[model samples]
Target: MIKVAFVFGFRNENWLGGINYYRNLISAIKSLPDRKIDPVILIGTRGSEDLLRDFPQLEVVKTTLLDRRHPSWFFRKLLYRISGRDIVFEKFLIKNGVSVLSHHHPLGKRARVPVMGWIPDFQHKHLPELFSEIELKSRDKWYGEIASQCSRIIVSSDHARKDLEKYFQVEARRISVLKFVVDYPKDLDLLDRAALEEKFSFEGGYFHLPNQFWQHKNHEIVVDALKILKDKGQKVVVLATGNTVDYRKKDHFNWLCKKIEEAGVADGFRILGVVSYGDLVSLMVHSAAVINPSRFEGWSTTVEEAKTLDKPVILSRIEVHQEQAPKNALYFDPKNASELADCISKALLCDTRGKGGGFPLNDLAVSNNFAQRIAFANEFQEAVLAAAYPQEKVHSPML
Candidate 1:
């Protein structure tokens, strides 16, 4: 069996999208029918205990020098500069018999094991105004390192693949575009819709934009749209959820709320920051449709979740969003609040066709999505195996 080490670098403080990406990936790997691959999550000092706790079906391994944020991480960096060896990390992998390292960050030069680098996006190149000088420099360094060092690069969308090749000059063959799939709750019908709505204080026909309040997420565009609708005497509500803190701009969320209040639409736009996954799903179930007005995206989890539920989404006209979201998505220019307002006004009036509230669970949809995810997992495994052992002609049963 091919053993792949999926490293957990994020914590609760990070965006839930990163954590959920790994969760979905692990779930896909576990559900594969071939059973020829063994997946393990390697936990570092700043590791996600929640990931291990949430996914009890998988084997969890704890490592000392695995995280970049670890206390001894600096020492390891210093040692690597001097000796050209991440002695502790290399030894840890060798001891655990981990054949490949599947991670988002750059692997050290001394990392003898094969690496499957995960690049979510090259957003910094496109949205330079959104990032500070330090952020841009650090991103450049990391992507440059990843492109040269990694055996295989994993990207979420073809858009990302093109971006990586264009900006970072990475070979197309080295990059694998794996369209991400969401694993929605199977028994969505079992949840109490009324109670959930009451619990979150949401009213009828509210749109769901379940993204963290990062600057690039473009929460301002949504506020601007709400203001436009309100001026026309049309009332529309939005239920926004996810981590509200933006380290790049500390006042981003507060500034957004201030904008909404100034626009006289504070009552219409609700910022229910960081709700539970259950509540988030319930919100989606009861909402008219999902929304993502981000200026840029690698692959939107909001769009994926909406697709899983077969719910409609009003999204930005960004290249990645167009590629990630369904064809019927109500598209709007990120800079044009009037266009989004028009879309929202129309969505509020339209029927969800039994999607809201008492929406029945779709077993076939769930099964088909999971099956597709399993196929993707098989593809990822084959790439990992091939990278880890160049001499061996790796053959997965599913393939």
Candidate 2:
């Protein structure tokens, strides 16, 4: 059995993106047979308790060093300078004879074990403003260095791989493209659809955009389209769901709320704070379409989940979204409000389908193929052994 670590930074339990990524990846990785894996999960002092309590499988390592603010994560910067924490983490991995396959940053750069780095997207290089100036520089430097140092790199979409190859200069062969899919969209066949709507108290005729109110998510454009729909006498409601307490993002959300009120569509749009996993699934099923207006994405699980439910999608015409989305989705330009409004109008004209999807549909859709992720993990184990004990003949970890 070969051990592997799942290294990540700070995350909120309620945040869908970070937590879901970890949960799905862990679920898949742990399925590897006879594997001795220590999914070494790292989080900030502030965010540690929630994940630790929730995920009993992880080997949690807490650090107060990184702040989840703009470009100035002083703790993370200190990570590069004070290598002891990583060294200690490394010692733990080395002692356990584990390989490290990272979901994110800093771990791969500091790793003595063979590191498989996960690069979600190269959006920092493409759109600098979404990230604070300090964050852009720091992330670029750190990720670029780690991409070069790690044994292999994983990206969620082909667009990301292209971007990494072009900007980070990593060879194409080193980067593997994996599309992300949600685990339980099918199992979310809760009760009959009518029963779910009644249980969740959902009235229907709404759309779901299950992304946080980040600037790049292009939520304002969504709001703009809502306004146009109201003017056209269309009774459309947009149920916006995400974390409301982000340190830097509260004001934007507040402003968006004010915009909704001013546009007289306040009654139509609901900004739900945080919701349970079941309610979220209910929201997806009842909604007409899953709308994503992201300025950029490595790959979006929202649309993927929507597809698995056989629901139609109305999305921004971004390369990454196009890569994962079905060919029949209603498309719009991410930046232009007029284009988005037109797409919304078009989507309203269509029918929403909720048919079942492909076989064993709940498999690894992100960062790996199902069986290959297991195979590569064993290969990673072998790499670490060959590095550690050069003289002995290398034995397969699969046995």
Candidate 3:
């Protein structure tokens, strides 16, 4: 089996999407019929034990070199700066028998193992106003290095692949598009939707907006849409769940609250900040429809989750969202509140409660999920093989 190492350096709750991506990817690989790849997680001493518990099936190697707070991490950085080589990290991967490193920062050109660098999106390039000058420079530098140094580069969407080609001038052959898939729990039927609704103190059908409170997420449009609905004497409840804070925009959450209050739709807009994974899934399953009003995305996890559950989605008309092409999605301009309000109105008329009422798992749903997992694993494995064996021509089905 080809052992591929996934680096887990994120410790903050705000990066729940990142954590879920790795978990779902590993689970997909393990589900393959032949199972030619063995996925391992490389975490730090400061990493969450909960994260370790989430991946009990995989081998986890904890090392001080990954922990930013540890002195060894600083020493490694100094050594890299002095010699332009990541000797400690390279040695760690070699000792652990890692054939390829995926989805981590590029380890310079001189690294021993094959590295597959992942650039989720070019959000900084498109939404430059949301980022500071320092962040813009850092992303450009990092992405540029990944394009030039890494043996293979993985982008989440073709939209991102275009961005990489346009902005970084990288050859199309060097980039691989691997759209990640969601792996829902098998025991979803055990989650009591009614009890969760009672716990959160909400009534009947509601729309779910589960994106983080980042400025680029464009939550102001949702607030405005709620006000438009209220003006028409229609009360629509939107249950928003995510981390309330955006480190880049410290006051973004408060600003959104103020906007909701000013629009007099505070009664209809409920912010349930940072819910547990099970509760989040239950809420999505039980909602009238899932909504993603983001102005930009690499590949939307919310859209994928809603699709896997056969739930309808009301999404913004972004290029990536169009590429995703969910089954029952209503697209609206992210900047137009009236358009989103119309989409929400139409979504409210559809009755999706039955899908989540008892969480029944039909044969069709199981088959579709199995097929999606296999496709994701096959594409990811192809990317790994291409990176590991650069001389051999590995044809990706995605390309």
Best by TM-score: 3
lDDT of 3 by residue, 1-399 (tens): 889999888787777788788878888888877756789888898788685445438788899999885899999999889888788898889999999999877777778898999999999999899899999999999999899898889999999999999998999888889999898755444357668777899777788899989899899999999999999998899899998889998998899899989999888999999988888888887788899999999999999888888888999999999999999999999999999999998887676453333453467977888888889988888889888888997654531
> Candidate 3 overall Cα lDDT vs. reference?
0.86
**Most accurate candidate by lDDT:** 3
Best-to-worst ranking by TM-score: 3, 1, 2
Say which prediction, candidate 2 or candidate 3, comes out ahead on lDDT. 3
Question: Which residue pairs come into collision in candidate 3?
Answer: none
Runs of candidate 2 exceeding 4 Å displacement: 8-11, 31-85, 104-111, 185-202, 246-250, 352-399
Residue 119 in model 3: shift from native, Å?
A: 0.2
lDDT of 3 at 263: 96
What is each predicted model's overall lDDT from 0 to 1?
0.79, 0.65, 0.86
Comparing candidate 2 with candidate 3, which one achieves the higher TM-score?
3
For all predicted structures, in order, the TM-scores are 0.93, 0.76, 0.96
lDDT of 2 at 163: 82
Off by over 4 Å in 1: 45-48, 67-75, 104-106, 185-190, 352-357, 392-399
